[model samples]
Target chain A: MTSTHDADGDLAVRTAGLTKRFRSGQVAVDGLDLAVPRGAVYGFLGPNGSGKTTTIRMLLGLAHPTAGRAWLLGSPMPDAAARVLPRVGALVEGPAFHPYLSGRANLARLDAGDATADPRTSRRRADAALDRVGLSAAATKPYRQYSLGMKQRLGLAAALLQPRDLLVLDEPTNGLDPQGTREVRHLVRELADGGATVLVSSHLLAEIEQVCTHVGIMSRGRLLLQGERAALTEREAARLAVTTRAGQADAAAEVLRGLGLADVARDGRALPGGAGTARLTAALGPTPPEKVSAALVHAGVDLVGLEVDRPSLEQVFVELTGEGFDVAR
Target chain B: MSRAEVLDGPGAGLPVAAPAPVAFARLLRSELRLVLGRRRNLVLLAGLALVPVVIGTVLLVTRDSALSGQGPAFLAQVTGNGLFLVVAALFLCLPFLLPLCIGIASGDAVAGEASAGTLRYLLVVPVPRTRLLLVKALAALTFAAAAVLAVAVTGLLVGAAFFGVQDVVLLSGSTVPVGEGVVRVAGIVAYVGLSLTGLVAVGLFFSTLTEVPVGAMAATVVVAVVSTVLDSLPQLSAIHPGLLTHHWFDFAEFLRVQVDWGVVGSGLAVQAAWVAVFGSLAWARFTTADVTS
Candidate 1:
């Protein structure tokens, strides 16, 4: 196997031209390139059937890739799966456990299945994990009796049974209520704060925006963009909205255009607040807000107000993928 | 957070400790627990135990004249030789009951996990697919052996109470000591258990072909029923030797004063061949098949 370590070993996950195609000839993941830097809370954002789960599966060695190579923790996957997987904890897609076994017993069995875990300490660790996930009261309940939220918590508890170098959670808060979602979000922040690299996948832009340090947006089995959260949001062009005196709306537009700003639009009528106020919006490309303010003042246009409308992540995501946000895929 | 606290937290600058490698023995133990701990399986076993009791009671209450000429040859001798009860019960169960239970267990080995959405988790444990398949097959075989033993033990206890143990009479017209007769009965029970190895392989192969446990179970039992049906058609004589159920009854040879090694050996060889063919097929399908669930 090839060594996965880069110069500084800063990447927790790396893939070069990774691809997977089902037997029916449907391409699930198409030559995907992904990089998750170490110590970063990377949110893998994608729609349903967008290949997020498939990519995660291949990285974990649960599904064989039809093309390309991937590495986890600086080790080439599958070839090094046995040696590398012990330090990686994952909760993929949804929770799955034996219906007959209690939550504690299920975790104990999963822990015992790990070659690196000491069986003697497994019971205590299982109990600790349950407590960490706030499922201590239901630890003895059979898994079948668990509600959807409880089952999701048990899945999280299983992933926390050991001290892991990385945590890969796919749609972790799926099927969770508002309170449950908040608890999971808080726990994710705590885990990341405690220093484990986490790769969490979700289609919720608001959720990703709140907790992720870096983000990768995927659509139609392809990654559209990946970068630091601040950098990505910074890349979007902020709109300049100018509220001018009633008769000066056309003058403000002409001034904005004369300043070499393209895509400038003048409202047909004055602002609803008063007959003297009119709003003109212009797309600011690389021009500072001070330039627009100075140009309007020099052009003798009465500027009632001027504000820079920075694009939200949701708008940026929609612009990047050419698809609507807010709807669950 | 304090720098000192950050340093003590998980994955913070501290080297991550690798978990202890899972032993093959532990995997086996876990597999056994998973297969045997189900309430459904326990109930199936209880039902199997009841078969012997019902058969023994019927034979014990009936008059000698009423049963002398009825049912299997072993049934006629159940009142005379108590050990025959064990052999008689095995004979009655082998054709369907034993194979049915084995089919249900083996068929659910992989498909059940897939349907429950647990197969993905198991594979991610880094348990090599081939090793997981082997473990599952072994668990199914263990169930088959245990099922046969349950019936045999139940039959022995019930038969010993209904009819006193005595020396055995062979189909060859020779008499053996009681100890030897008990040993022969054990050999027959073991042989019957071995006879189901082919069915276990068949069930496992079907299991790998689908994600629905019920579909796999029905398909596996159907395969056995079809094989038996084909075995009964003398017109298919050319293929009779190849059928899985053709040599199922060859264990009867163990009842003779001098065992027919030729027939017994051939039976075992056929079962082994079936195991090899179907076992390889299961491994091939499982290792290459994508787990979407």
Candidate 2:
């Protein structure tokens, strides 16, 4: 993260050493410095136990941090919360609403709470938002009767009640069917195209990988990486896979180990050469393929085939946090 | 409204979203609807309204029996003129039922939203924590006033039906026309409503301390119960005047021929003190609270 010395109007969300320590002495978010550029689809990626929601809450002034400060839309919070929050829309920790209130009434109620929302246009705008989320049919159904997907759509409608410049959505696609998830992805892109900076948090990389312009990876209460999506994934080296006799797989691993590959390991994947074949996978790092092949042959390990594969963001996450994510479904 | 006009820092020199009065009125109206429109809350108010009807029915049926003059003084007071039933019912409900109704309504003020998980959304709507608290407290207070009037108005109707409305006899032995008597009944309702504001504040403060509405409701009712219990102990007379329920029954002074404004003023003063202390405490706890739920 860049130093927060410059007050960049280009940045929509900025936090400096933002931390949250609960009364029980557990640190939920540790010294997080977030810089989300204007109009970018920023994905905040973290596992379930990570503090993604906590960080989002702190940013939105719903949760107070124990130390440090934050600014939203170029003003300090929560001193500026009354002034700034009206311009930003958010959906955090999934959908919550009055059980007895209908989906339309719920959106209308939320719009009424927005100072910037014109009371005369509130019902119209709420209906429009419901249409936008494809929940118009169930608009009059009581919230308690909504299916999980419908409830999520209402939450999105509430967040879109006013034309906001920034949208902070935490796991917006949660509880969505594949069709609904696709719609959410499409809607996000549509919103991003409309010039609103979208800060979306998710544990699934593939969910955001398609549309995210920038990505911030967080694990165990700390930010591990933050930058343009291309650069983050490009920084990870390609993987080297070697196929050989099952008996020589350990020797090929030893050879790759000798070549300074920290991730050298045997693969459980099926190999081309019938019964006795085996595969070994390792990070290619800076090593040349010829040296790997020569080392394997020099060690009497016959190389049937060798291939170099580009690393996935999942591998990048594993490399950084030493823990795997529940892959995107 | 334009986004740029939605006001930011004071130094922005931009137009605010709307006039302060307009925004506050809108917010307060919305809160009142949310609080009073709920079916459960309507049930609570209806329950209070029925108390007077039940009392009036019992007294009307037993007036011919030896049971007359056997119950509380207000019960006997109802026989002479039905207008006194308003006073009788208000007096009967004050100790437990009135506080319980308000407790259920006001106790759920903040905690209800928290438990429903809507508190975070409201706060982030940028309603300003202090303003949100003000709206919640006002909504609950409105519910409280409604609860008081429910019993009084219903009592008046049942009294008129049972014993027939007539001129009221003051405790000091002066007679007043039925119209004047109703005016005093209104006065009693207003005073009873004022007496409960302190409890409203207490409920709000407790509401902010937890996410469980039932817990807040119980705590609020318990506070009233304990205060009433303590007020009855002669040995604790030193703290009687300062207790929440101390001045509750003092609304009887409103029934006097020449109202003692001093006693009325002191009762209101006690309520004001409680509101001031508890209101500020609620604001303090709520404004700085982290809305994790």
Best by lDDT, which number? 2
Clashes of 1: 8
True contacts kept of 1: 0.42
DockQ list for all candidates = 0.30, 0.35
lDDT of 1 by residue, A1-329 (tens): 12534312578888888899988899989988888898889999877888899999999988889998888876688777776677788899999999989999898778756766767888999999999989999999999999999999999998898888889999999989988888888988999999888999987767656888999988878888898987888797778889988788888899899888878987666466597788888888778889899999999998889988887778887887677864426
Instruction: Write the residue-wise lDDT of candidate 1 on B1-293 in tens digits.
Output: 35463355332553333433346667778889988888888888888888889988888778455545488758888888778889889999888888889889999999999998888877776566887899899999999988998899999998888887999998887899999988888889888988899999999999999999988888888888999999999899999998898999887888898898999888888999999999999999998887888
Q: Which stretches of candidate 2 lie over 4 Å from their true place?
A: A1-6, A239-308, A326-329, B1-16
Please give the distance, in angstroms, between residue B16's alpha carbon in candidate 2 and its true position after superposition.
Answer: 5.0
Candidate 2, which CAPRI tier?
acceptable
RMSD of each: 5.2, 6.1
Candidate 2, residues A150-189: lDDT per residue as tens digits? 9998889888888877899999999999898889899889
List where candidate 1 sits over 4 angstroms from the true fold. A1-8, A239-308, A326-329, B1-22, B64-69
- The i-RMS of candidate 1 is 5.7
